[model samples]
Target: MTETELLLSLIDDKLRKCEDGYMLTHTHFLSLGERSSAMAHLKNRYPNHVFWGGYPDAERSVLFLLPEYMEKDDFSLEDEDDPLCLVRVRASSAKLTHRDYLGALLGLGLERSVIGDILVGEHGAEIIVMKSISDYLIANFEKAGSASLKITVDSIKNLEPPKIKTEFIRESVASLRLDNMLSAVFGVSRSDAVEAISRGMVFLNDTEATKPDARIAEGDKLVLRGRGKAYFREQSGTTRKGRLSVLFEKYI
Candidate 1:
């Protein structure tokens, strides 16, 4: 079965248990894409039940699917030392990048969803992982991109998010279609942008975006696979040529 199907079954079972006055949990962590799907599924199927989802310190989170009587604060995901663990990795030469650390982690046969946000900073990074494989990763995840680094198993209590790099961008597009937006902001050809989107190399707000002609609005986050992540800031005034004048931010 697909991952979404599995989550649907899990949610169905959990919803029944929640109605029976039991607060059940998922046995897996969720990636950004999976989290988006799961939330949409819950909003459609179990709209009334209360659900809380968050990673200990990372940006991407899990779903709690709480019952009506349970408050979000009453749940102590961290105080109970939740199923998440933080792995602090620092290379001495400062040559490590976000992909390097992630590549190393994945090389150890870890699924992407079991891992949360990977905060990359200068000289090092902190990886939020499911506790089930924390030891396996710490012992085996010792090198990244040809450099050996130190890995520490840590709690999620004191993780500071990485300082993301952003650049303001202004461009004019013929339309609000995703390909046009991507081409305008990144200076790619419209055909190339369409090809990228068709190849499943694009994500709109963390979910896989397959429609190249989908409209891109202000506040939308566009992630170009292997390229970069961009956020639509606003629609500025139109240009004299009748093109749409748009402003956005690209995370570098």
Candidate 2:
């Protein structure tokens, strides 16, 4: 079966489990694209559902299917009953990258679906993962790349994600079109931006953006797959050449 078909089947099974067994059910961590697809497919069919990944602004999230008596707000990421756990891995002084931590986790034979975000810091990383494997990780997860890791399982509340670093960019665009804004913020050619959008490599506010000419507004979040993420902070003013002066907070 196709990936989408398989995902839909899994969602159906989770829904069935929640409806028939009358309990909370959740899926493995899903990427941004997967979450968007799942939501588009399910829509208003399920009201007692939520997409969460231990935090509010998590790029990867799990879909929780709740019973009839429960509401989405009834679940808490910090609750002991939650299916997610925070694993803090500290190293002596070796700086580890996200890829290093991910490589080590996959090297340990863990599936990517079981892992959520890997927040890398100067000393180590904080990982959000399924609670089922928390103990195993604490016991077995040892090294990331060349850095020896000190692992500890903590409450989800203790997960301190690395502070985001952003670069403020001021540019002028002839229009607020998605492609135009992407070109200005990312320093890519207009044609390249359009091509990226056409190839489904661009996302606007967590949804896949297919139209190059789609109007972009202030406060919209844009993600260029291979590039990076940028937040349209404001339209400062109009340039002398009739272009719009835009400010973007580009995640560095």
Candidate 3:
């Protein structure tokens, strides 16, 4: 088998529950093709259990759901116990990105024509299940490796939202000097921003403004094509002649 097929074989075997009447779920950050192949395996192996998948296009990751092992006393599920979990992962990529769990839920809400209560841990996204999804999480959580299982079944109870503070606010501008503005606002070296400015990455009001010392004023939109977008405001104060205090909102 190919490397991808081999990986799926391992995951399929590892995801099955030992007990009958148990459900299985799988979540991972595999590429699009890999996720499809895994789904196919689930279709063939376990047709009865609920199986779902999500591809966070912006974040470029996948999360799978298996809902067969939950402890539900009745059809009424508003009071289900411990339904969500968070697992911290050391992905192969060095850069870390966030997936907005609530954002995903909003989409599901639109699709189902119903709003559902989803409890997500502070660290990761939430998954909903009835009888089998819970079991799948447990089985996959173990097979996901100790390092991958950053969270456990118990942690999902009464989870709270994680807080993140805004570091900078973005604004629109007409034009700006490369070295003076970007260095102060973005906290980068003057030389580096200047270098990027010279390379024609910086723009003045949507047009590529190449001059590092370009005279920017209020109402001018400065867009750094690769980096982000910004707008310049009138000088509120001045630290130096070349360097003046200006208000700008930066795109994240």
| Strongest candidate by lDDT | 2
Instruction: Estimate the TM-score of every prediction.
Output: 0.79, 0.91, 0.31
lDDT of 1 by residue, 57-169 (tens): 23467566666665656765653547777788878768788788778788888887688777777778887777888778767887898888888888776666556679999
What stretches of model 3 exceed 4 Å from their correct place?
1-176, 239-243
Candidate 1 deviant stretches above 4 angstroms: 11-21, 47-60, 71-76
Give the per-residue lDDT digits (tens) of candidate 3, residues 1-252. 996678677666546542332543444334334444555666666544322222111111232334445422221123343233333322223222233333433433332112122333434434433222444444543311112333344333333433322234442222355666766566567788788777756655434556778766776766554565565656665554444557766545
Q: Write the per-residue lDDT of candidate 2 for residues 158-220, one digit (tens) a residue.
A: 776557789999999999999999999998999999899888789898888889999998899
Worst 10 residues of 2 by lDDT: 71-80
Weakest 10 consecutive residues, lDDT, candidate 3? 51-60
**What Cα-based lDDT does every candidate model obtain?**
0.75, 0.87, 0.44
Write down the TM-score for model 3.
0.31
